[model samples]
Target: MDFKTVSTIGLESSPVAQALAGLRANEARYFWNKYKHEFVTEPAANNPAIVARVNTILGERDTHFETAPLEVSDFEVAGVR
Candidate 1:
């Protein structure tokens, strides 16, 4: 299929797309603790409690990101809102 058609294909109904989507998610969080966890912290040197809260939010977002539905429209690279 062409790139335009492929880009719009609904992932939920396509096994190939779904598997690819899942693989991307797995790769994204392969080192979630190492890469993503750090970004949760703000620029300011906050207290220990604030740091902990940031970690908690990052953990939760990672969890939900994997379990969420595979929607091609939701992931449109250029037009994502």
Candidate 2:
């Protein structure tokens, strides 16, 4: 399978950004091999609607991440959102 290269442009603030990117790449490879799905990420700032939707979803549990979300993965896996 051909793996798509992932970008770490927005993850600069994280201390282990490169490692995180590598881990994401590994996840992409795994998903591609197992489900033939391509994992993609978008800069959070570029997609406010997605971010707001995520916040609303998280509100159901009264749990929210305090750190700024630099990027987000917005996709369905096998028809599950």
Candidate 3:
């Protein structure tokens, strides 16, 4: 498959494209600097396990995240979950 940069695909309909892009770049930088690992993202619909894990954690604290996430990144960084 051909690699696609964020600039080359999507974002035309997003009003906060600039901010979202900045956040994405920040995530990449943090993971790279802290763990020397590449950041990864996948559609939330395809990753029920990740979603369930997050919800379970929040449930323990009785906290709720009202908005559903459109994407998910799952990985351990430097022994931290």
Best by lDDT: 2
TM-score per candidate: 0.25, 0.74, 0.71
Per-residue alpha-carbon lDDT of model 3 for 1-33, expressed as tens digits? 011244412333456766666666677777777
Model 3, residue 77: C-alpha shift (Å): 2.9
**Clash pairs for candidate 1:** none
| lDDT per residue (tens digit) for residues 1-81 in model 1 | 121122323344545765655554554443343444211112123354554554577788874333334331111223432
lDDT-sorted candidate list, best first = 2, 3, 1
Model 3 / residue 19 / CA error / Å: 3.1
Q: What value of lDDT does candidate 1 attain over all alpha carbons? A: 0.39
User: Which of candidates 1 and 3 reaches a greater TM-score?
Assistant: 3
What is the total number of backbone clashes in candidate 1?
Answer: 0
- lDDT score of residue 2 within candidate 3: 16
Ranking by TM-score: 2, 3, 1
The ten-residue window of minimal lDDT in model 2 covers 1-10
Please list the C-alpha lDDT of all candidates, in the order they appear: 0.39, 0.79, 0.69
RMSD of each: 15.1, 2.8, 4.1
